[model samples]
Target: MPSEPQPAPYLPDPRIETIAEWIGDPVAPAAFPRHQLRWHNRRWAAAVGLDGFDETRWVQHFGQFAPLPGNLPQPLALRYHGHQFRTYNPDLGDGRGFLFAQMRDAGGRLLDLGTKGSGQTPWSRDGDGRLTLKGAVREILATEMLEALGVDTSKTFSVVETGEELWRGDEPSPTRSAVLVRLSHGHIRIGSFQRLYALEEKAHLEALVAYCLETYPGSPPPPGAPGREEPAVILLHQVVERLADLAASWMVAGFVHGVLNTDNMNISGESFDYGPWRWLPRWDPRFTAAYFDHSGLYAFGRQPEALLWNCAQLAQALSMLVETAPLVAALDRFGPLYQQAMGRRFTARLGVESRGPEQDAALIQAAERAMVETGLAPEQFFFLHRAARNAGEDDFGTLLRLHAPTVAADDAFWRQDAPPGVLIDEVERIWAAIDQHDDWSELHAKVEAIRDLGRHLG
Candidate 1:
């Protein structure tokens, strides 16, 4: 955990100030304040102008829920309704976490500092709202891997191990507890609009749509499309494109975002709130990350389907206030958009550029067939033919040679005996060291290695 020297002071500028009614009143953080700030993401902190703060200040705000100067005076538990496993559930919101503060990044995009296990909120059904230290560690690993693979993802800004013990039905009981702060483009989900629709709050619903478009602005509407005539339709088109791009990114990265619930789908299309996430071991489509996923609904290959279904739910919400024709038009673009995004991202990851959708699609099919034939995980096939590093006379190698190199093959991480990967077994081994002996040497080393992979991919 290297520190940022001579960082700037923290300041808050609330761009989403108009929609305060959507947030629940702030409650006090749980009294489990041992204040052991374990991991701080200096990369994100610097971008958010938080690099100047010391560790103590970090713990006070992130761990203890203290308000930052000029920031939100109180934390806000956001309100939303979501569908879980194809079942619409109107009783879900921020259960264990809340939006602590809102600020802007170096790119001037609005960012929300939301928590995972700060404490219970209005939606705390029947469980204690505390995060296990292992959970925080897993998310750190997830975001690191996703970011390295160029997947749009939320950055784990800070993690603090609070002095508490939690019992859960999932992991071993009496595990240590921690708090995680995530920096995202926006916390508003498709579910947020659903909640407003459920309450029959048309004005609030339209307000949310307006807020989202203003905060997370997207590209101009497609040339003279119907969406150009309506702001809500325009927003829907942007979301559909983003979600399509997000789904393709997951496929190219070999990531299974175990749960693809409506609540987990950020309107900004950034991936966050990782639970039971796993990297693909092989190019198998039926690989499911969550153990309880008996139906394989959110499997590795079905990720695009799940995302498209969630997008339909968003379209459904927007339909309440506007006509369905333009929204459906936006939804229709998802298929072709996904294909193009997948081809572009897949080729970029393999260090090439797409010729056109047809040629690119053929190349993608050839690459997948090659991976499937040998059961080569992305970690193997990508680096095996990375920018002319290990080209061969095979079809896949010949396909690679046709495309000119886009990146210099100077990274030792890719040339090493084993390319960087985040399989479940590896994650468990890293966790076992900490769970048994509180030794984070392996975890720290993994973080550094993942950073190197990010640099290599860049």
Candidate 2:
């Protein structure tokens, strides 16, 4: 673990008068971990004007604020049900999480600001609504790493240790409890819409659709026949496109959301709920993050399909709002949109200029086959390929030889044009540029350059 930093001073949002004003009630304090008190996220706090809210006094009086006045949407405790790995569960909503409030950001973007592990709420079921320190740490790491990898993701707002302990059957002793605040576009899930549709709540479904369009009008409407009057159909189409783009982005970054349940699928299409997630070190399409995913439904390569299925559920929910023919037409666009995004990403990763479908497919298949046969880590291969291209054919030959020992008969083919002595010199120069300092900004720039070449080729 990295050395923990001390808590920074609070910087309140200019839009918010106080914490109480933001939440409608005195913000409730829930104690869990002492070590978890370290919230040294000054940059993020400053970005959202939360630097003024980082004070120790505010920490002590977290649950004591009066409601803040604003155009912030009222965050009702929404109701919804979901299928956990294909098994239907009737009771679920804000389980161990709650939408604290919704507010527009500095960019005039509507975002739902919520807290996980705030406290036990109506949907607590048999367990506490508190999060473990381990969970918080993992989320922090995920947010930072994923953002660097260029994925659209939720950002962590704040983390606080509540100085309490809770036990679960998975662990021998009780773990420390903590609260985490996350900033997202909207917390409404595909399941929220699905549940209403399932229960034949047409009025509520229409209201939800209307709310989404009003909140996120910039999003594209359904495939054909657009207008505000067709809010339900338009909203459904918007969700499908978002989900397609989101899934493609995940695939491009070699990310596995692990769980793609309807409840985990955000209508905004932004990646949310970073639980049981993993990044691929190698490009195995079948790789999965969740150990219990026996069916391989949400495997690395199957994310797009899983998203389509989830969209289908959303479409079913919207049936009450639109006729079947238009709904099917809207659903049809998912495949093409997903493929387009995937094609762009695959081309970007390969350092090859993107041509059309044939060229993209050939390059993608070649890379996939090479990775599987050579047992080379995807990142390692990508780095080496970029280095080879930058250093010329001779240096590339040397890289192939260096990595050759890791493969089998392929070594003979790769070593045919050995670049002799100069390869190491070129590699060292590039490596120095990449690893000269511990600062990640310099490192990320180098990686982005390599990605840029691929995009240019595409």
**Winning model by TM-score:** 1
lDDT (tens digit, per residue) of candidate 2 on 1-458: 01111233332232322222312232343443453343445555544445565466445423322233343333334467776776766677776766655554555556666677776656668877777655665576566545544566787666676677778665334765667777677777788887787788787777777767776665565344444246676777788788887888787666788998888888888887977777675778898888889889889999888889888888888888887766777788899888777766665554444566655555556566666766766555654454134223443333333323221322232233321111123323433442343233433344344334323222
lDDT of 1 by residue, 36-75 (tens): 9889988788777888779888888888888877788888
Q: Which TM-score value belongs to model 1?
A: 0.95
Error of 1 at 203 (Å): 0.4
Instruction: Give the Cα RMSD of candidate 2.
Output: 10.0
Candidate 2 global lDDT? 0.61
> What are the per-model C-alpha RMSD values against the true structure?
2.5, 10.0
TM-score between candidate 2 and the true structure? 0.75
lDDT of each: 0.84, 0.61
Q: Identify the candidate with maximal lDDT.
A: 1
